[model samples]
Target chain A: MIEEVAVALDVGGTGMKCALVGADGVVRHAERHPTDAGRGPAAVVETILSVAEGLAGKAYADGLTPTALGIVVPGVVDEARGVAVWSANVGFRDVPLRDLAAARLGLPTALGHDVRAGGLAEARLGAGRDTGHVLFVAIGTGIAAAHVVAGRAVTGAHGAAGELGHILVRPDGPVCGCGRPGCLEAVASASAVARRYAELTGTDTGTATTRRTGSASDDGSAAGPGRGRTMVTAAEVAARADAGEEVAAQVWRETVEALADGLATAQALFDVATIVLGGGLAQAGAGLFDPLRAALRDRLTFHREPRLVPAVLGDEAGCLGAALLALDQMETP
Target chain B: MIEEVAVALDVGGTGMKCALVGADGVVRHAERHPTDAGRGPAAVVETILSVAEGLAGKAYADGLTPTALGIVVPGVVDEARGVAVWSANVGFRDVPLRDLAAARLGLPTALGHDVRAGGLAEARLGAGRDTGHVLFVAIGTGIAAAHVVAGRAVTGAHGAAGELGHILVRPDGPVCGCGRPGCLEAVASASAVARRYAELTGTDTGTATTRRTGSASDDGSAAGPGRGRTMVTAAEVAARADAGEEVAAQVWRETVEALADGLATAQALFDVATIVLGGGLAQAGAGLFDPLRAALRDRLTFHREPRLVPAVLGDEAGCLGAALLALDQMETP
Candidate 1:
């Protein structure tokens, strides 16, 4: 009897993670490719199809039958209709990537939102495993979340549920990428933390008021390469905070505070069992979790404190999640 | 032919709405009774059991076969465990309500949260019907909400999901009943609206600062009967606002603004298809929906706007929802 596997691909702005995963969720084979999203969504769709077909061929070569296909992309996904509605990074505008891939590969397929898929992987195969109600939050350049009940992630009517990063945390804080001011991600995401540190340190020896002064550029050049070699990233800031640097400590504290506020609000609404924190910010380990846990506890009243833990899948989460989706698409378990 | 009916009861702080509903979701018979909660938890439990049994008997007398039982109470419910874990209003502490009802009536039973039950009714049979994903918000003396998808209400890890009232909207707003500051209920609940209106008018020609004044009595007496008949309820405020009362309009505007913030945050997280406004405040009808719809639209950037509608269930929603839960518990369904 031939072993069966799901051909899976997780497409991002810069690259794609491809894999053949067994029904048991173990990855049988894995590979990577550049997405070349700058070439436009049409080219990206072609790349995805060819890459998926190649994975299927590889599965056959490895003595396994490709049972189904699953693909996850960063966009507003219409999962029921198998359409990629829109994506800011990939420029996907109403692309029916699922049908196109299914036609090329001759298998049942599932399309999903990238962040939601990553959260699914985390909820089922990573930190949130065994936790029936899970809220998976990824704190990277831009924050995102997925609320998983049992083993399924809720894709809201418009497939835009779990926009945790954009949930308003501060009313008068900062403008977010979504044009909303004081969104949780505006002040607490990994990129936001690094940016805040840079902003404060640039006008050194002054209190961090989050206000602009004469030294800062008009169009925000300090956030760019114009700040020279003095600029530091979020990871470095965590290290500095851990080492007792006042500015870095302040920035880290502020990030933790904002994240706590966002998570508390999340708990009030979701009331999940576990909150699996992933992406770059979770890499800080105790530096992030300890303070965040404390702050979140302080903010909650009657809410059962969700178990806070770092995600275990790392970068492969989306690919594994795609595999899970594919396996779910098969008629047989 | 004997019709199958579900015996259901919705227990609140003040009253219990009991009914026997048919499989077609029509109530065969309905009645109301005082909860008499001051007699304590045990009495309340006895009252619920007797009321449920009476409803079942009433079904049989009406030539209908009672199939199952469902009891909804205002509190922390353990749906999976079939227990009423906690209730501030009814004074229940870990009562095995479902099992007790099942044992008493020799029928299948389900225990659910009151607001969640009402939301289930709204989502399946009321205003939210036909909408795939529904968020039912009840803004009366206090604000509460239920998130229902595909007919089932999401009972979080602690059976505490959909605490929309407690979600933080204002960082510097009034203190909530739960001791949290700036909760949505602190500023947007019906009681909050009425309180604000009174405070503004009492200190006439002054903006509502949410602060206590010398004339307001030191012991919070203004909220009690000691105000010499000056106290006005939320309905009065709404009527006044509609009739062009300046203070009422300002109070209503502020309430709408705060509610919009809360609902926008809810949309960002849940992204439901429709939002059904129920309970006391929803009685204002278009006076609330028209402005709230616009304000919520203004807050969204990438989010799909959820349909704003008034709940059609009125006060019977909870009883009907209880029937839904009971019907859902039946094996044949």
Candidate 2:
């Protein structure tokens, strides 16, 4: 008998992580492809469809049956309608990606937001596996969150839930990408931290140390070259903070404080059992979690203190989450 | 043939709204009683038990069968544990109210946070009845919220969910009851609005005008006399603002802005279909809803604009919600 598998793809602006995942969530086959979003949405759609077909063909060649397909994208996704409502990253606007994929591949398909998919993967098979209520926060170039309750991630009514990055943390702080001042993402995101550190140190080569240290697992968008050689990543700042550099410590502390405020606000609203910190900044391990946990504790008055832990699945979480969504559709349908 | 009903009670710091509700979500009977919390937790519990018992007795006397009992309280509630974990208003500390009520009433019991219960009611049978995702915000002496999705309120992992009041909207605003500076509750609640107006006008008699106007639908906690005769409640401030009071307009604008910020934060997270405003402040109706709707719209970008409306159930929402909870328990059990 052929082994059953699901085709899963985590589509990002720069690349796509494709995998054939078994019923038990183990990746049977994996591949990568450049998204080349600069080519526009139509080309990106064609690339996604062809890549999915390739994966399905590979599964057949390996004597595996492709049960379903799950595709996750970075944007507002109307999961119920299976439409990619909007995504600035990939230029998707009301694209019926799910129906298109299903029609092309002759399989049931599931579509989800990438961050939510990552959160689902974490809740079901990674750091939050044991918790019923988990909040997966991705802190990279941008900060977003997914609230998973009882193994299901909440897709807000308007497909716009989990925008944790926009919560106002500093009323008079820096302006955010969303055109708001003092947004949590503007102060605590990995990119924000790097920008703050560079601004404070007047050094553009700060990220050089991060690249030198070989900790380049950050989303590529946040790792681009700065104006000068002194540009540093948040990781470098974390290292400097650990090494007792005053300016870096101050920047790191502000990041921690802003993150704590944002997390505390999330806790107040979500009250989840655990908060799984993922994406680039969480790679700092103790550097990020220690102060964040402490500051969150200080901010909470009567709320149950949630366990804050690092995400375990790393970059694989989104693809795995896509697989889980496919698997869930199979079970439900 | 006997009619089946559930005994429901909405317990507050100062009063309790009690009702016997049928399965069709109609109240067969209703009554009110002073909580007299100054008598302490034990006496308050006794009052609760006796009132529940009396309601059950009334159902029997009226030829209706009381199948279950549901009670809602304020503050941290361990709904799963059937415990009122802590409530400053009622001075309850780990009171096993559900079990106690069950033992006395000889029926199945459900315990819930008052606001969550109210939200559940609003979602299932009140203002939000038509929407799958609803956020119920009660802006009284303190602001609190309950997010209801698919007709059930999210109780959070630790049973301390829906604390929307604590989300920081203004970082440098006044200190909140929770010892936090700039909490939404500290700036936008009815009491907060009243306090701000009084401070601006240097008059404590703000609520006096409200009393004179004879619109005392406000929670009694905010109706007490202020230091002088010219004081004003949030309602009075609204009235004054309408009558061209510049100071009142400024105070009201700040309240609206702060509230808008808080609600925008909530909308960003929950992405609910509708936001139902309850409690004393919402009594201003168009005065609150018009500006709040505009401000929320201005703050939101890619997120769907949620409908803002006044809660219909008024003070009865909690009791109605408790009844709904009891009826739901019966179905599940």
Candidate 3:
């Protein structure tokens, strides 16, 4: 008998992480494709459809029955309606991705927000697996989160839930990409850290050091991806802080403090048992975790301090989560 | 045939609102009793048990079958285990209220948190009735919230979810009863408005205006209730603001701004379709809603602004919620 698999795709701004995942969560096959968002959303959609068909065909050739298709994209996704409502990077506005994929592939399909999908995977299979309630914060160019409860991520009423990055932390802080002043993303996101560090060090954003591109990295801003396009990465700032550089240390402290404040607010609202940190900034590891943990503790009162841990699934969490989402939909239906 | 009903109790700091509600949500009978919390937790427990038993007896005497009992209390509740983990007003510490009520009344019992119960009722049957996702905020001496998704309140991992009031908003603001500085509760609660007004007017808290005694009102703080004893009531402050008093206007503006900030954060995270405002201050009607709605709209960017509405359930919401809880439990079981 052939094993059953889910055709999954975790679409980001610059690249798409595609995979064939078994029902047991094991990856049978995986591949990647450039999104080339500059070519526009229509081209991107076509590319996505083509990639999904190829993967489905690959599964058949490998003697595996493709049970379903799952696609996770950045931006506001109405998971219930199977629509990609709005995305800044992909230029999607009310695109019925689920139905399109389902029609094109002739399989049951699940569409989810990328961060939410990643968070679901993290909560169910990564660092938050032991906890029933998990908050997955991905600190890339723009920060975003997914609140996973009992293994299901909450997609807000408008399919825009878990916008942790936009929550106001500093009333007079910098303006966010969303045009809001003092948003958490503006103060603590990887891009924010790098921007602030550059502002202090007198470096330019257009021409500077390269930001690393992860296997499944996502830039949640509407403007698009920022890979290899920064004066300095958040990791370099962390390194500088560790090396006892004054400006870098100050920037790092400010970033950690803002993140702690944001996480503290999330804790008060969701009361999750664990918070998993992911994305480019999370690559700093202990350098980010130690200070973040202490700061989060100091801010909490009667609220239980959430366990702060790093996401262990690396970049493939989103693809795995896409698979999980498809499996979940099938089970529920 | 005897009509089946659920005996419900909404326990607050100063009073207990008791009721018998049918499965269709119609109230058959209702009454209130003074809590006299100064009598301590043990005596309070006994009183509660006696009251619930009496209600059950009354149901039988009135030709209605008492099917189950539901009780809502303030503070940290472990709903899964039916334990009133900790409550400042009720002085509860790990009291097995559900089991106690169950044993006494010989009926299945459900224990719930007060604000969450109110939120549940509001979402299912009141102002939030039209929406599937709602955040019910009770702004009394302190602020608290319940995130209701599809008529179910999120109890969180530790039964302590939806602590919106404790979220940090004004980091430079006053210290809260919970020993935290700049919490939304400290900056925007009814008591905060009254206290700020008093400070501006130089009125002493021990002897001035009286905060009204509300039915089914719970003070959600570990430091206990602060009602009737405040310097000036938030209602009076609202009146002053409406009368164009500069100091009162400033206080009201600050409160509105903080509340807007808090709600925006909630919207960014929960993306609910509606926000139901209840408790003492919401009684201000348009005075609070008009400006609050505008402020909230100003703060939102990509997120949809939740419909700001006053809770229509008034005092019986908690009791009704308790009844609903029992009914939900029975059905699930």
List-wise, what DockQ does each model earn? 0.52, 0.52, 0.58
Index of the highest-DockQ prediction? 3
Instruction: Score candidate 1 by DockQ.
Output: 0.52
Estimate, for each residue in A201-260, the C-alpha lDDT of model 2 and write its tens digit.
675453321110101123823644434543577788889999999999999999999999
CA shift at B19, candidate 1, in angstroms?
A: 0.8
Indicate the DockQ of the complex predicted as candidate 2.
0.52
lDDT of 3 at A280: 83
lDDT score for residue A135 of model 1: 92
Q: What is the lDDT, from 0 to 100, of the residue B17 in candidate 3?
A: 94
lDDT of 3 by residue, A1-333 (tens): 889999999998778999999988899999999999889888999999999999999999999999999999988889999999888777788899999999999999999988899999999888999799999998887788999998899998989899888898998888877877888888888778877888898874543222221112454221224435546667888999999999999999999999999999999899999999988888888989999999999988778888999998888989999999988887984
Error of 1 at B327 (Å): 0.6
As for candidate 3, its clashing pairs are: A88-A222
B256-329 in candidate 2: lDDT tens per residue? Answer: 99999999899989999999999888888888889889999988876789999999998899999999888888
**Chain A structural similarity (TM-score) per candidate?**
0.92, 0.94, 0.94
Per-model root-mean-square deviation over C-alphas: 5.6, 4.5, 3.5
Error of 2 at B307 (Å): 0.5
Candidate 3 per-residue lDDT, tens place, B171-231, comes to 8888777777788887888777877877788874543221221222454211224444435
